[model samples]
Target chain A: MDLINSVTFKDLKAPLFIAWQINSECNLGCLHCCEEAGHPMPDQMHKDQIFNFLRQIIELKIPYVALSGGEPLLHPQFFEICEFLRQFNISLKVETNGEFIDRNLAKIFARLKFRSVQISLDGATKDTHERLRLRGDWNKTVSACKALIEEKVNTEIVFVPTKFNIHEIGELIDLAYSLGVWGVYTGKIMRIGRAAKNWDILCPSDEEYDVFFAVLNKKIAQYDGRMKVYYYPYDVIEELKYRLRYPSASLLVIPNGKVKLIGPLPFICGDLRKHSLIQVWENYKQAWSNPKVVEFAKKVIEEPWLVSEANDWIELYH
Target chain B: MVFTAHTKIREEKFGAVIFETLKEKIFITNRTGKDILNLLQKGSTLEEIVDTLVNSYSAPITNIRNDVTNFINQLKDNSILTR
Candidate 1:
């Protein structure tokens, strides 16, 4: 099948990918967490509602679904939801911190055949990793990697480059490669959520970012096909362009069941509870014409800093 | 030369999407490239491909032959085609 064909402007009724924030609950309060998710929010959608939404997702024929959040694994019915998604042959990807993954959980993931499981590993050692992750234990993450690799899970590591861990980028990539991971995704920390409050400390300087990418590009070229390494915002521009061409290419379903284009952007397309997924999709399509969304797109391209400042859009639009 | 067994080609509105599953590489082509790929999939010979394109398009036979040959050689280099 044509992979690019899957991404087109012709389809407004279906989205190419859905970023489903299962719940705003996480065990670790990482310094760079965009959602600032730690405790389980009371307003999260219930199990039945999520299942109903999944049914709508299948009916709409969405090709890919990324289960994200503070951490999706913390959801009470996480496995049940994965099993349900599997029944419909939907491609699944999960974003997690890797702390919850043990031998048993790794086995479950392998058996389910997830397209990819991206685990956050910000630093090479406990001192560096825990510095940003706060409650994270580097040893546990290493053990989780071993377990997942043992089960032959298609595992990938996510490295959020910050001032605290910027020096360890090379070491971290080597570590991920040694752990038998299929890919390593590293990106500059966006100034949002908890990171926003600590931007001065957490954000790397422009020169630091340029140096980091230079080294990362060399490493990626050297490794070639052995393991893939991607730098975010840099890599995401293509996806953003695709979204600009077809505004409905992505749909972010928040913890409370409200859909938005990019999570930080304040535009509410529709609430899953009140509207069917199809109706929500139509609302998303309608959003492209909204003067605010159009303006936001223009500003995003011209003023890159606006991406880091979520609330700034609120001020500009509201 | 024949298209590799692992290569999968799909026709798209703009052109064609060719995937080499073994290499996990995807290539997109223009309308003429798509037509060339379609002919290759049907096991057409190099000369036949040139002849077909010459008939379908307004291009001269000599130019069509050169382009088809270059295209096939490029695909072969990329491992999308094999003997």
Candidate 2:
């Protein structure tokens, strides 16, 4: 696509990307899953509702979408959704656990020409990886990653650093390089979902963060531009301020059709199920300044622990 | 039909991307949007844009007009275009 910048929220008619939580279902029980996926929701988005949202996205000229879930690939109509998106110029990115992405699925993903397929692999060593990813098969994840790379699909490993996995950051990067994947996307694990339950153990200590920065730089140098390493330096206070100051252009669509802010604010801007996308978007533009949203942002800033209570979206505005 | 100085347009393989320098925001358009932007960059009139689209694409003239109008209005609303 072409390059355009120097813009304000007014210039943005629609979200450039939609982080659609396709379903509240997953097979793996990751220790820090933000969606806390496993059991499927009975009232999950109906097929018609999903296609309706897809039509809305097309009408708005959305260019990008990320398909995520408890496990997005688990959606029965996932391939159909990909085919539909292929009809338009929209680019897709998939977030998967890599357990179910066998050779056939990997081939299908490659054929679809996704922008990137990010698979979660918290640890480099099998012992460490399984420890973080409860019920996760290390061999399956590695094999799935290898299959994607073999099929020439752009693959990136999503890693979460904690005290257990902090020391393995370099090794994980090395492993990613050896696999010949595209990139390594990692950051401080958000204290939400199951993570909040076990934060006392999963949260990395200050000493471990010192090792994280050093090894992260060392691996970047060692890779020598062969692989991309994306590390988001997450600071809650700064992020809260920035998010409040700058208007958000993207809307986070949860599996239940609730439109909320991208980061874990927990304030529901509008419900896509209740109104058309345009109406919801119109409301969402002003939602940041809505007293409820503003107060929550300020509260999160002052009492960062409030984020721990943000496991579910709170319906305040529509 | 020229884009304002606030906007910088770059042509890409799929479509053109418009950059608003003031806000440092980007607008990614599709191939059709690229075609329209190409005409605007050349200072083509709105009627000429419609005429060109009518000749080039198989869509009905009404749909084409609406799309062009909406695209233009969006840009104008953002001050990327003045008139």
Candidate 3:
């Protein structure tokens, strides 16, 4: 039913969802590493800090949370954090490399009723996948996916289209189908961190992208909802500007509790350690109009130096 | 009778999130709408869905039917579901 009077993102008190980088460490520093995550950061949040912010999550009644990492499973208290969030009425999801998901972990995911588990696979074939990720990781990840799918864990494959792997999307779709995955999410690799450093070599040409999407669309129609296809073909600048107007709707929470508007642009709007989630959201809303942010966005569009500030958290003066 | 090829329905604690991948649009559903979508996913026909809602919910049969029909129509209008 349509509403009588509508409230949009501007009117929201808290974020609709959160993309929380629970830890700065990751298993593989792949070509598309937005965080450029490798080892845990020096300022990584302590368990107390994370739990404190989670308390704020409950207080604000945030409905959805998508946990990520370097690899989220690498976080020491990962299961404890998941259990804490599950106690509340939060709809939880995870983005992982799928290296750590085993039969027992998959069973735990099923028991916890995770909304979705996104496992990244750059390509269908081992050579391409290994080239993008770690060698032998493709096999480990695919095995993890099989475990999760076997336990009916609502698993989805996350593919980042690039110059290296766009050609094999047809085979990738078939692989997802064979694995009985719930969905296939193919999103554009944004220009940030490692992606920015490797933009010349990594970004797919427009024609390459067109061909890739054509194959993807054909498979979508052929499968006919048997395997869901989710594609996000957004330009980094456009997506950043869109997030500016609607910052409160969804947020990116970095490992140390700093809130970033978008990954491609370096703008830290708030600190969860210092403020409540709502307060951080209010800070985020103002960050969009921050002259520094506008200048940075423009500068990145012109010069290619945003790479230096890629993973830097440029805290706003709010 | 079924969701569109790229359409996905993910249920949440508060309600459900419907993804229309063709346009990259997202729609949120309340408990009633979520239940209707769940039934549709389970291959329940329109009449079966209405009957089930009428029997379970305290609303009148006509009202339930009206709500279900409108919800289904919205899904169809958005190209999220098809026969």
Candidate 4:
């Protein structure tokens, strides 16, 4: 049948999507931030360099781009970058903390017609959310969602299921639905960034995660496509399945513009500044065949804890 | 007639995935359907496709012809296969 769909993993000649981390800068000090991003990093790319990168991405004709960071909106020229990328007809998804999204920002996003803006909303209540996100203001986030929804900007919620907010999974979904979000995405807290330091406090126990997933599954069934609910690490299984059907399907770009096979893995394919998009992609594909990378991928699959211990491995290897 | 210039096809285990980049549409088809598409990709005519399928498959010629016709019509309707 004629299915109106975006580019699938199988259709891509190179990488299907690029997760572009504009900068390692975030306003809030979230305990579970995988990048450990809070203050603006000194090495953040200049506006001109970002524009050049966007031009190269367009030239390479990458179909999908996910703008992320400490907070992508924190980039001085965030809207300018988005506008530049829009010129090349790239489908865009922005991941943000939602604090920066006001009525004006919502209008800008609606005008741009972005694919979706995924905002983090860890809990249903202020206390629960702030417990993990630290200085996160619940009302501001709620208002941002409402404004985005009202402006008809495609909005999604990201809820990282941690010990503090695991019990609030159902309530969070209800809250997202009430805010008229298109989806609610959640995943296990990876042991990276500040989360690695606070693993004992932040990481949920196996049983806790199991219970949380069960609740999520039930809610997904209840919603039944009224709203989308996605859980990561678990969803990585779907990626593995897709890989079985079509080989060579994913890539990750860190804040420093280095291409990696996985976010946590220290294996660097190539730096975007030095290499062309195709060169970086070829390097990534080549790394997939490297014995070290292959073995690492295998080990990560076999021992899930390896992902949590990625920072240590990176230090040892890099 | 041939598949549109914007359309690209990739073989999958169970079927083939057809992507229309212009419209951003994806079409997944069965092996038999994929077989037809493979032939069409190299600029095969309806008669040629039917003849090839007759040789390759055990189905009755009339049934194969009817199915191929319907499939081609569907592709055309979807602007996947174009003149």
* Candidates 1 onward: DockQ, in order: 0.08, 0.11, 0.10, 0.11
lDDT per residue as tens, model 3, A160-278? 88898989899998999999998899877777787778888999999998898799889989888587887775666666556555544678998888888777777788887787788
What lDDT tens digits, residue by residue, belong to model 4 across residues A142-247?
8999999999988999998889999999999988888889888887667666887888898788899888989999999988769887766633333433343344
Which segments of candidate 2 are over 4 A away from where they belong?
A1-5, B1-83
List native contact recovery per candidate, as a fraction of 1.
0.00, 0.18, 0.03, 0.05
Q: TM-score per model for chain B alone? A: 0.91, 0.91, 0.94, 0.92
- Please report, as a residue range, the 10-residue window in candidate 3 chain B with the lowest summed lDDT: B15-24
Candidate 2, residues A129-225: lDDT per residue as tens digits? 9998889899999999999999999899999988778899998999999999889988887877788787889889989988898999888777766
TM-score of chain A of each: 0.90, 0.96, 0.93, 0.88
TM-score, chain A, candidate 3? 0.93
**Residue A38 deviation, candidate 1, in Å?**
1.4
* Model 1 lDDT per residue over A1-318, tens place: 122334343433466578998888888888888777888878789878888899988776665678998788888889999998877766688998889999999999989877778888989988999999988989988888889899988888999888999988988988888889988987666656777787788888889888888889888997788998877663333444556665645688888787776654556788887789877777777777778877776776666555566533232211
Could you list the CA RMSD of all candidates, in the order they appear?
A: 5.9, 8.8, 6.2, 6.6
Q: How well is each residue in B1-83 modelled by candidate 2, as lDDT tens digits?
A: 55664365655555666656433356777778889888888888888999999998999999888888888888887767877
Candidate 3 matches the true fold with a TM-score of 0.80
The residue pairs found clashing in candidate 4 are none
Q: Top model by DockQ, which number?
A: 2
Give candidate 4's TM-score. 0.76
Residue A222 local lDDT, model 1: 76
